[model samples]
Target: MSFIYSISANTVSRRVILSKFFKQKRLYSSKRAIILGIETSCDDTGCAVVDTEGNILGEALHSQHLIHLNNGGIIPPIAQDLHRKNIENVVNAAVKLANLSFNDIDAIATTVKPELPSILFKKFESMYI
Candidate 1:
């Protein structure tokens, strides 16, 4: 006499995968956060708006390459001065492109550390206004 044991394999159901996908989508949909990123640590003044889902809504950047090249080098005072003048326009353009107003932004992020000269830091701080 011979006897054989039956074996079975279990497969993941489609509903399980779909349920997980919808759960993830719900988590992402529950809230919206937009970040305005400003980078003024160097000769390039840049601004970007991004959402929590890793989408860039808008961006604007202005480079001081030509100005500094004409001067043969970056003059600290001139770079800081130029940033002061261009930051407003850059931020405004980015906001408009993103189709958002200042009030709609959840937060503003800027490079404010690794302190530069006192005057330069002050100039960067002024952009917050």
Candidate 2:
């Protein structure tokens, strides 16, 4: 299994980025690779399952815009808490939408932004590592 971390807001951009990454790394086989992407860099918890052909198998997103708006602005701690609360659900929803389990995924990808709080990594490690 392989792990690739990434951060992007647009679906098209993510595909492009992943394509380049896979190609540059020469990580391909006769079978198209299936990727699970997780994003929690900013105000949303997003997950998606996609194939090497740029097909979007499934996707889920949880936004914190409203909560932050209510709070006047994004607070790091609140954002971290929300990501912790939503990451699993979002990933599961995407996998479910794809009608496949984690066993079917070839690789896992996630956003690793500098501004991200450390607590989010703890949540991810507990779930996936």
Candidate 3:
């Protein structure tokens, strides 16, 4: 089994610099928000950074399809271990691709629910704030 991670809106902060310098409802407000999305529901691990306007700033992904296929299907423990090992690299690549650091991200969003294991869900949950 390959570990899966999902995107969530936890790492972003809503901070709009409302100043008189350039008023009149900016198209993409500073408060528009930037989100880092991570998805790991099955054999693919994906991460993306997007703005509130639905613009993708950066994205990274890793697929374990070949690994699983060679094994004749995913083994839960194997999948979980793979996810654990690859998540950090995936996330780091996303940040680099976005040309931003963790502080620049407004939030982090990951899928957490019936689709993912509770332990994996909790791992992302702790990244909030």
Q: Say which candidate scores most in TM-score.
A: 2
- Report how far off residue 109 is in candidate 2 (Å): 1.1
Candidate 3 lDDT tens digits, 95-122 = 8998988767655665553343345545
TM-score of each: 0.67, 0.75, 0.68
The lDDT for every candidate, in the order shown, is 0.64, 0.73, 0.65
How do the residues 8-120 of candidate 2 rate in per-residue lDDT, one tens digit apiece? 56532122123334554454546777888777777888999998899999999999999999999989888988998888899899999999987677676666663563466
- By lDDT, the candidates rank as 2, 3, 1
* Per-candidate alpha-carbon RMSD to the true structure: 18.7, 5.2, 9.0
Q: Looking at model 1, how many pairs of residues clash? A: 0
| Model 3 clash tally, residue pairs | 26
Off by over 4 Å in 2: 1-29
On the 0 to 100 scale, the lDDT of residue 13 in model 1 is: 12
Q: lDDT per residue, candidate 1, 46-93, as tens digits?
A: 889998799999999989999999999987778778877888888888
Which is the winner by TM-score between candidate 2 and candidate 3?
2
Which stretch of 10 consecutive residues in model 2 shows the poorest summed lDDT? 11-20
